[model samples]
Target: MTSPGVHAFLIIVRVDRFTPEEKNTVDFIKKIFGDGAAKYCIVVFTREDQLEEGQTIDDFINSSDQLKELVQCCGNHKFAINNKLNGQPLKIKIDQLLRMIDQMVQSNRGKYYTNDMYQKIERQRKREQARQEEEDRKKKKAYEESLISTGREIGRQEAEERERERQKEQKSREKEPQKTEKPEKEQYSTREKICGCSCHKYPGVIHVVPCCSGTKFPFSLLGP
Candidate 1:
């Protein structure tokens, strides 16, 4: 028979006689309560207690591998009880079982199960962030280098273009002609000559005069 209480006590009764329905009920109880079924203990209860009168619980458990395995699954906790009596032994066993539960709860206080997993996740996130930062740094450096190279190429082209324009201007100046200034003119006076006297048959003249101004000869005149 199973009873409901504030706290469940898992009592495993290893008995000689169990109906199929009772076995099924025990399986159902274990499934429903699970690990929350506290203060659990395995009791080897039987009407014939003489079978284990001289043997300890450990001795009997060790006598068979199946029994040893069962006890191990129950946290190696077992008790011998008389099925015909409800006495001090049962109370003492229950009290010890409760104390063991209290100790287990105390030992596990403030402890979590997923701490290692959380740490692993944090480390993974940091690694990924670092990888992304490195990639970004490489990309930015490559972009800056490309920009610098492009700027250099453009500057070189512009310098060559300026040099070409200068040369073209020089050639044009060489092909043009130069202009010069004209000189001034000068003035001069004209002179005239005349004869003073002439011989008709002999054709001899002794004085000379200017035709336009009437100037006389100075030295001698045969005829004036």
Candidate 2:
């Protein structure tokens, strides 16, 4: 059944005794083909000759809840056949089973379960996972870069603040040096007289006399 797929799954059982394991066969098939397999299933009850006289398949199914539940899971499609029959009777049973399968196919819109369908679902799932991972990676990278940028800005601001504080401290401690200046010398006049004499008559005689105060007088200033 796994090589390709099938249009229907016939669950065969004996009408004389429907075992617990047999009742769960449809569930096992669903596990293999997925939940959609149930719609394409048909429960076929064999050994109809063992049934009580005037007992129909529906009457037998209604008597047991387990059988009824199983049939309902298969869209309530069920059939009974006596394997001991031959010729036209056996052919009729086979033809009826085939007709039921054809009706199911028509109800399914002419589509069959295939391995390709499962593969396509798996491929789509992988593609979606890859896309989500890529998006998450981009978001994480952007968040890291933003954090780095914020850290650099904070470091720059702190450095600038430290430099400003240092400059202010230096300015507060600075002072100008004091300066000293020299005094100027006194100037002397040359027109002062040393003695009380009128010496305006002298023509060229140059003299140097010393007064009592130790000051010097010229010869042109001596008295007659």
Each model's TM-score?
A: 0.31, 0.52
lDDT of 1 by residue, 95-149 (tens): 7766665554444452322334344555766787899999999999999999999
Off by over 4 Å in 1: 1-113, 181-224
lDDT of model 1, residue 89:
75
Alpha-carbon deviation at 85 in model 1, angstroms: 44
Candidate 2 lDDT by residue in tens digits, 1-224: 36555778899989988899999998887665567778889899999989899999899999999999999999988888997989998999899889988898788887666677656545666787799999999999999999999999999999999999999988876754446667664233224433432343543333334433455555345443
Model 1 worst lDDT run, 10 consecutive residues = 1-10
Candidate 2 has what TM-score? 0.52
